[model samples]
Every structure is written in C-alpha cells, then in structure tokens.
Target chain A: MTYCVGLRMKRGLVFMSDTRTNAGVDNISTFRKMHTWCVPGERLVTLMTAGNLATTQAVISVLEERSKAQGERNPSILEQPSMFQVARLVGETLREVISERSTQGQAADSAFGATIIVGGQIDPGPPRLFLIYPEGNFIEASEDTPFFQIGETKYGRPMLLRGFSEDLTFPDAIKLLLVSFDSTLKANLSVGMPFDLQTYVADSFEIGHEDRITRDNPYYNEISEGWGRALREALGQLPPYDMG
Target chain B: MTYCVGLRMKRGLVFMSDTRTNAGVDNISTFRKMHTWCVPGERLVTLMTAGNLATTQAVISVLEERSKAQGERNPSILEQPSMFQVARLVGETLREVISERSTQGQAADSAFGATIIVGGQIDPGPPRLFLIYPEGNFIEASEDTPFFQIGETKYGRPMLLRGFSEDLTFPDAIKLLLVSFDSTLKANLSVGMPFDLQTYVADSFEIGHEDRITRDNPYYNEISEGWGRALREALGQLPPYDMG
Candidate 1:
C-alpha cells in the first residue's frame, strides 16, 4: 500500500508521497516514489507512483535512459512540447512495462499494474496536473477537481475535500498535505515516514521549496499532536444532540 | 456496501447503521439493518447486519419466529441466560442462512456471506459486545477494542479510533458516531441517510434511547454542517508547517 497526493493551487502545484514499500506484512523497505526532471528554465516535471514497485521502477528507468544525451532521445519526456505530451509518454511507458512483464508469462497483467500522477509546467503552457491510470489513459485536474490522490486514499480524503481552495497559499497547501498524510500514517502501517515533498510555482519553470520530512521532524510531530487536541475541542463545541 | 457500528462505553452500548442497500449502483433501497429483541427486564439484544441482505434477513426472520410464543421457543435468543450464548446463536444462524443459500446451488458461498454485530445483556450478566463472522465464529469487544464496524468501514474509522473512550458519556459517544457516519455518507454514495440509532444502559436489561434520524433531522444537519467548519478551524489552529 502507498499514499500519494498532488494539489493544484492558485499559487502552483504541491506533491507529497510516503516512501514505504512492502511485499507483505513481514517484508518491508523504503523506496522513494517521487521522481523529478527539470531543465531549469525550460520545464519542470514531477511524477509520483503507486502500485507494483517493479513496474514503476522500470518505467522510471526507461524515461531516465531516454533523456540521456547519448541514448535514444526521439520519445524523451523532457523534449515533449507540452505537459500533455509528457503525460502521454509516461502513460505509454507504464503500459509498455506492464505488457513486457506479462508477455514473459511471469504473472497476470493486473499483477504488474501501476497508477501515476504527473504534473508540472512546460514552457508557455500553464501548470497542469493529471492522474494516469493503469490502462494508460489519464485525466487532468480542473476547477471542479483541483487535486489527485492515489493509493490508501480514503482515510485522508474528507479533510482534503473540505479544506482545498483556489486561493490557498504555498504554506497552507503544504500544511493541508501534511495533515492528510498524518491521518494516513496513524491509521495504516504500510504508509510510513520520511515523506518526499516538492512544490512548483506557476510559470516559474523551476521547482519551489522541497524537503524530506523524517519521522522525528519537529513540525510533523507538532501537527500530529496538535491536530488531535484541536479535533477534540471542535467536537466539544458542537451543540449537544437533543435526545428528547 | 453498508456501514454499521456498535460501540461499548462505560454508560452501556450504542448502535447506529445506515439503511441503504443496493444490488448495484442503479438499484438502491432503504432497509432497516438494526434489529432488536428484548424481554424487558430479562434481556436486551440489538443486532446490526452488513453484507448479503438476503442472508441477514433470513437469519433475522428465524430468530424472530423462534422468539414468538406461538412457535418454536426452545432455542430462542430471549431465553438465553448469557450474552455469550446469544452471540453464539446469532453466529450459527448467520452461517446456517449462508450455507442454505449456497447448497441450493444459487451462487458461490461467499455471495451469501454476511457479517454481524450483536451486543446486549441478559439476566445475571453484564452488558457485552460481540462481532460475528460468516463462519459461525465470534469475538468479544474488550477494553482495548470497544467498537465494531462493518462495510465501508475505512472512511469513518480514524475518527472512531481517536474519539472512543471507556469513560465517554452517551451524548458524547453519539456525537462522535454522528461525525463518523457523516464522513462515511459524504464519501460513499452506497451508504445513505435515514440512519437508525439505539442505546442501552448497563444492567437496565432494556433498550434506552432509540431514534431514526432522517435526512432533514435538524441535529444531523447541524452536525454535518458544523463539522466542516469545526475541522477547518482545527486545521487552522494546528501550527503551520515550516517549509524551510
């Protein structure tokens, strides 16, 4: 299981993902799920994956190799004219990886499936966000839906639904994402600490504040502990039910 | 999908369940899922069901018939001397209904499986709570685990885990449960409104407050709207994340 979310705010886009990966309850390891590619002033791309680890890693490796100067570069994500094309390339790469694994008769196609969230700015195009499915099709975030979440999403969704706004600032967006992640971490063991966070500003063509939040991060601890008390007090403030 | 919960507090037991049942997204109907059988001063039992509606209704029908004075009363739940025996009878009845459906070759065994939460008190016994599985096995709720929820449970669980306390009053417990249910209702279309609620006080040997909360129920409306503001305020009160 994994938890990853990308929010498209008025300021820009903010992405956060947990690093824990597990084959089963007995076997667990940490692997970064967020990958980034930036050509400084030209473009900035961020991708977060959730699902079969092998499939995601293969797709990432293929994208990385194609972007290299000495290798095949015809279909490189970095060279795509628009964020839409970059999303298409990533989707096709994910589909290709899954089909390749299944053709070897290693496992069923569904066993190698993965979902992805790819978003960022490409030159003159405005910053955009998309949730790419295992089938290789994708949908962009819009006014009605300003965010995307994949893997272990339910526990953290209510807060996100109620709190998101177009006028949110970079700091508040990060705070919201942390609260969502904190709820998930406390409820499920599969999603662990050492979170990767990256923010992008509209038209900046460069990544904004980025950090790796560790288990003992002072701010993370404060939010986790303080939110509980806040919720209790909030509950107390509601008028008592008239059980007449 | 459904949502039903039975919570045990020092004051006694509280139960709530949504009434929406569906064969598919297009076919949905409201059906009461909370069933109660009480002998007034002798015993009080409340059972909440989730899963195959047919199996649950059959089990409830059988229990009701046996409890009638005009029919077989030998193994009736009202005659049970202890809450444990009542739990065992309910579990066995559930298993019987499921196997009977499958033996007729109607469908797979799992298609008729149902899970139940039955808890109350009989003469000479303290209030107790039990969660019964489809296999005719059951587990009692202890101090460490004082609540049982079935169907569409994840969306509403984090709040229950954080809010439940042995020393909680009935009003506070109901408030917590309403907040939990409101979260589930908003997140899932399959779990709809007109919720049924029942509460039992320890050693009373009879049901206490019982109410059917409809969509326009003023207090529910208040809680649902108030919770959004309360949560937003709570988030604002938490120390802002330092994106340094």
Candidate 2:
C-alpha cells in the first residue's frame, strides 16, 4: 500500500508521496515513488505512482531510457508537446508494463496494475494535473476536482476535502498535505515516512521547492502533534450535544 | 454496505449504526442494523452488524425466534450466562446463517459473510464488548482496544482514534461518534442517514438514551456543518509552514 496526492492549486501544483512499499506486512521496504522529468525552461513533468511497485518502476525506467535517446520514434514524456500528451504517454507506458507482466503468466492482470498522478507544465500551457488509471485512461483536475489521491486515500481525504482551496499558498498547501499524511500515517502502518514532496509554480516550466520530509523534520512533527490538540479544541468549539 | 461502531467508555457502551443498505448503488434501501435484547434488570445486550444484510437479518430472526421459545436445547442469547456467552451465541448464529446460505448453492461463501459487534452486561459480570468475525471467532475490546467499527471503516477511524478516551462522558462519546459517522457519510454513499444510536449504562442493565438521528436533526446538522468549520479553524491554529 502507498499514499500519494497531486494537488492543483491556483498558483501551482503540489505533489506528495510516501516512500514505504510492502509486499506484505513483514516484507516492507522504502522506495521513492515520485519521478520527475525536466527540460529546464521548456517543460517539467512530475509523476507520483501507487500500486504494483514493479510496474511503476518499469514505466519510469522506460521513460528514462527513452528520454536519454533524443528522437521522435521513441518520444519521452519530457518531449511531449503538452501536459495532456505527457499524461497519455505515462498512462500508455504504465499499461504496457502491466500488460507485459500479466502476459508472463506469473500473476493476475490486476496484480500488475498501477495508478499515477501526473502534473506539470509544457511551455505555453498552464500547469495541469491528471490521474492516470491502469487502463490507460486519465482524468484532468479541474474546478470541481482540484486534487487526486491514490492508495490508502480515505483516511487522509476528509482533511483535504475541507481545507484545500485554489488560492492556497505553497507553504500552506504543504502544511495541508502534511496534515493529511499525518492522518493516514496514524491509521495505516503500510504508509510510512519519510514523504517525498515537490512544488511546481505555474508557467515557470521549472520545479519549485522540493524536500524529503522525515520523521525528525521539525515542521512535520509540529503539525502532527499540533493537529491533534487543535482537533480536540475544535471539537470543543462545537455546541455540546444537549440531550435536552 | 454499512457503518457501525461500538465504543466502550468508563460510563458504559455507546453504539451507533447507519440505516442505509444497498445491494448496488441503483438498488438502495434503509434498514436498521442495530438490534438490542435486554432483560431489563437482568441483562442488556446490543448487537450492531455490517456485511451481507441477508445473513445478518437471518441471524437476528433466528435469535428472535429462539428467545421467544422457552427451552434448554433452544437456548436464546437472552438466556446466556454471561456477556461472553451472548457474543458466542451471536457468532455461532452468524456462522450458521452464512453456512446455510452458501450450502444452498446460490452464491460464494464470502458473499453471505457478515461481522458483528456485540456488547452488554449480564448480572454478576462487568460490561464486555466483542467483535465477532464471520468464522465464528471473536475478540473482546479491552483497555487497549476500546472501540470496534465494521464496514466502510477507514474514512471515519482517525476521529475515533484521536477523540475517544475511557473517561469520556456519554454525551461527549456520542458527539465523537457523530463526528466519526459524519466523516464516513460525507465520504461514502453506501453509508447514510438516519443513524440509530443507543447507550447502555454499565450496572443499570437497561438501555439508556435511544434516538434515531435523521438528516434534519438539528444537532447532526450543527455537528456536520460545525465540524468542517472547526477543522478549518483547527488547521489555522497550527503554526504556518515556513519553507525557510
């Protein structure tokens, strides 16, 4: 299990993902799930993956190998003309990897499936966000859906639904994501720290602040503990359930 | 699908269950999932179920019939010697119904499976809570595990973990449950109002406050709307995230 969120904000795109992956409870390992591609001022593509680790790794490796060879025959996600095309490339790559794995007859098709959140800018186009399914289909984030979360999402979702807004500042958005992750971490052992985070300011065609938030990260610790106290206080603020 | 929680506090036990039941999104109906069998001054037992509605209903019907008959061989849950025995009776009945359904060759064995949370006090014994699994096995809630939630549980669990405490008053416990259920209701269409609530005060051997909280219930509306506001305010109370 994993937890990753790609949030589309008014000013930019924010992405966060947990590094922990497990085949089973006893067999757990830390693996970075966020992959980034950039052509400096030309394009920036960020993807956070959740689901089968093998399939995600294969997709990323394919994209990386293609990007290394500069040709139209095997275009990299970095070479895509727009964010939409970039998303399509990622989805197709993911589906291809899963299809190859399932064709090997080692496991069921669903066992090799993965989901992805892809977001970035391609020159003139605005910063866009998309959730790419294992079936090679995708949906873009819009006014109604401003964020996409994959894997172990439910525990962390209520906070996002209540707190996220279009005009949120980068720092505030990070804070919100940390709070959401904190809720998920507390509830599920499968999703653990340290979390990978990235921010991309719209139209900059460049990545913004990037950090690896570990358990010892002072800000995360503060938010985790402070949120609990704040929640109790918040509960107190509600009118008492008067049996009268 | 359903959402039911049985919370154990210092005062007694608090149980709440959503009334919504659906075979599919297109075929939805409301049915009570919380049932109580109390021998007033002798014992008070409450059972809240989640999973296959048919299996749960059949188990309840069998128990109802047995309780109506007076015999040693046909022992009813009400005739149980202790709260533990009552849980055993519920578990056996659940397994029996599921087994019968599967043997009829109608569907898979798991399709008829259901889980239950049963708690109460029988004379000379303290209040006890048990989570009965489909396989006729059960585990009691103790100091470490003070609550049990069945079906569509993840979205609402964080609140219970953060808010529940042994010393919590009945009103506060009910408030905490309402908040938890509100989160689930907001996140899932399978679980909806009106919610049924019942509280049993430990030695009284009688059910305490019982109420059916409807959508238009002022208190629920207040908590639902207030909780969102309170959560946002709580998030604001945290120190600002500084990228410095």
Candidate 3:
C-alpha cells in the first residue's frame, strides 16, 4: 500500500508520497514512489505512483529509457509540448504496461493495476495537475477539487479538505501536507516515513524545492507530536455533550 | 451507507451511530441504527448496525419479536447470562437472516451483508463489546483494540486512535465520540445526523445516558466548528518544513 498527494494552488503545486511497500505483514520494503524529470528553463514534470510496484516501476523505466534515448519513434516525457500532453503520455504508458501484464493472466483491476498523479509546468503554458486512472483516462484538478490522492487516501482526507486553499504559501502548503501524512502514518501501518516532497512555483518552469523527511527529522517529529497534543487539547475545549 | 462506533473503556462503554441510510445519492432517508433492550437490574444491551438496511432491520425485528413472545424454543437476547452470550446470539441471528435472504437468489456477501457492533452489561459480568461479522463469527474488543467502527470508518478513525483512553470519564468519552462523528459527517454525504448516542456504566446493569443529537443541536454545532478551528490553528503552530 502507498499514500500520495498532489496539491495545485494559486501560487504553485506540492507533491508528497510515502516510501513503504508491502506484499503482506511479513514482507515489507522501502521504495521511492516519486519520480521527476526536468529540463531546466523549459519544463519540469513530477509523477507519483501507487498500486502494483511492478507496474509502476515498469512505467517509470519505460519513460526514463525513452527520455534518455535519441529518437522520435519513442515519445519521451521531456518532449511533450505541454503539461496536458505530459499527462496523456503518462496515462498511455500506464495502460500499455497493465495490458502487457494482463496477457500473462493477471487480472487488470487486481493487485497488478496502478494509479498515477502527474503535475508539472511547461513554458508558454500554465501549470497543471492530473490524476490518471488505471484505464488510461485522467481528470485535471479544478477550483472546487484542487487536490488528488491515491492509495490509502481516506485516513488523511479530512485534513486536506479543511486546510487547503488556493492562496496558501509554499511553506504553509508543505506544513499542511506533513500534518496530513502524519495522521495517515499513525492510523495505518501500510503508510510509513522517509516521505518525498517537491514544490513547484507557478510559471517557474523549474522545480522549486524538494526534500526527503525521515522518522528522525526534527520538523517531522515536531509535527507528529505537536499535532497529537493539539488534537487532545482541542477535544478538551469542545463544549461537553448536554447528556440530558 | 452508515457509520457506527463502539468503544470499551474502564469506566463503561460508549456507542454512537448515524441515522442516515441511502441506496444511492438520490435515495436517502433517516432511520435509527441504534437499538437498545434493557431489563433494568438484569441486563442492558445496545446494538448498532451498518451495511444493508434490510438485513439489519430484519435481524432487529426478529430479536425483538422473540424477546416478547412466550417461547422457550428460541433463545432470546434477554435470556443471555453474559455479554459474550449476547454477542453470540446477535451474530447467529445476523448469519441466519443473511442465509435466509440468500436462498431467494440474492448474493450473501454482496451489498446484502450486514455488520453489527454489540456492547453492553449483564449482571455478574463486566461490560464488553464485540464486532460481529456477517459470517456468524465475532471478536471481542480488548486493551489493544478498544474500539470497533463499521461503514465509512476511515475518515473518523484517526481521532479515535488519538483521543481514546481506557480510563476516560463518561463525559470525556462522549465528547471524543462526537468529534469523531463530526469528522465523518463533514467528509461523507452518506453519513449524517441526527446521531444516536448511548453509554453504559459498569456494574449498574442499566443504560447510563442517551441522547439523539440533531443538526440544529447547539453542542453538536459547537464541537463541529471548534474542531475545524483547532486543526487549522494546530497546523499553523507546527514547525514549517525546511524545503532544501
């Protein structure tokens, strides 16, 4: 299981994902789920994946191999004219990988399927964010729905719904994402730490900032403990039930 | 859809359930999900249901009918000597109803299945809580697992995990439950007010307190708004992420 979130705001976009993957309770390993491709001064594309590790890895490898190769025969993420085209390329790649795996007798919608969140900016166009389904279809984020979450999303959704705003600063958005991820990590064993975070400022055409937060990181620890204490204090302050 | 929770604490037990049931977004109505049967000084049992409305209503109707009828052939919940026995009786009744419906060609494990949370006190035994599955098997809550939630559970679970304590007072427990339900209500359209809440005090062998909290209830509104403000304030106080 995995938990990844992509937020599109007036100022920029923020992406965060956990690194834990498990086949069962006894078989668990750490793997990065955030992949980024950048052509400085031209475009920056970020992809976060959830679901079958094999499918996600295959999709990423195919894109990376093509991007490094020299030819128009194989479309590369770096060559996409706009963020919309980048999303289309990623969705097509995901569908191809899943279809190939299905021919080997694996169910298409079973554990072999994967979902991806694509967000980036291309020169001469505005920044964009999309959630690509396993079937090669995708939907872009809008004002009413300015965020996308994949895998184990419910546990962390209330915070995002209540805290997200179009005008939030980059620091505030990252803080909100950390709180959201902390809640998920505590409630579910499947989502764990060493989180990968990246931010893109609107119209920058470059990756603004990035970091990997581990369990021992002071800021992450502060948010975890501080949020717990704050919740308890908040509960205490609420008016008690009338019980009459 | 429905949302119900049962918490077992050192002082007593707390049970809360939303009254909304819907076949789909357009077909929604309010129906109480919390049922109580009390023979004061002997036994007090509270049952909360989630899943197929038909299955749950049938199980409750059967239990109520048998308890009032003059029959020694069928064991009624009122005749159970221990809380554990009460849980077993409810689980068996749920399984019977599901099987009966299945003989009519309905799939037993489909949307027709129902899950129940049974909690209460019987004379000579401590208060207890059990989560009865659709398959006639049930598991009791213990120190490690002190609560059980059914239907749309993920949105509200983090609050329960962070606020619950074995020694919480009845008032504190109710407050915690209200916060949990408020989160679910805001995040889901399927789960809504008015909520039914009940508490049982150990050794009393009688219901302690009960209330039906509606949307216009002042205390409910206070908790809902207070929690949202507290969360935002908490997010602001957390150490900002060091985006390097």
For every model shown, what is its TM-score relative to the native structure?
0.95, 0.96, 0.94
Q: Residue-wise lDDT of candidate 1 within B1-244, one digit each (tens)? A: 8999999988999999999999889999999999998888889999999999888999998987745676545448877779999999999889998888888865563488899999999888889999999999999999999999998998888788777888988888899999999999999999998999999999998889999999999999999999999999998898776766
Q: Write the per-residue lDDT of candidate 1 for residues A65-178, one digit (tens) a residue.
A: 845676555437778999999999999999898888878865553488899999999999999999999889899999999999999999999889888887888888888889
CAPRI tier for the interface of model 3: medium
Clashing pairs in 2: none
| Native-referenced DockQ of model 2 | 0.83
Model 1 chain B: weakest 10-residue lDDT segment is B66-75
Model 2: CA > 4 A from native:
A66-75, A108-110, B66-75, B108-110
User: What lDDT tens digits, residue by residue, belong to model 2 across residues A1-244?
Assistant: 9999999998999999999999879999999999888888898999999999988988988888754656543436766889899888888888899888888766563588899999999888899999999999999999999999999999999999999999999989999999999999999999999999999998888888999999999999999999999999998888777766
Q: What TM-score would you give candidate 2 relative to the actual structure?
A: 0.96
lDDT of 2 by residue, B1-244 (tens): 8999999988999999999999779999999999998888999999999998888898888988754646533438877999888988888888888888888775663588899999999998999999999998999999999999999999999888888899999889889999999999989999999999999998999989999999999999999999999999999888877877
Tens digits of lDDT, candidate 3, A127-201? 899999999999999999999999999889988988889899888899899888998998889998899999999
Q: What is the lDDT of candidate 2?
A: 0.91
Ten contiguous residues minimizing lDDT sum, candidate 3 chain B: B66-75
For model 1 the interface RMSD, in Å, equals: 1.0
Task: Please tell me the TM-score of chain A for candidate 2.
Answer: 0.95
Report the poorest 10 consecutive residues by lDDT, candidate 1 chain A. Answer: A66-75
Please give the ranking of all candidate structures by lDDT, highest first, separated by commas. 2, 1, 3
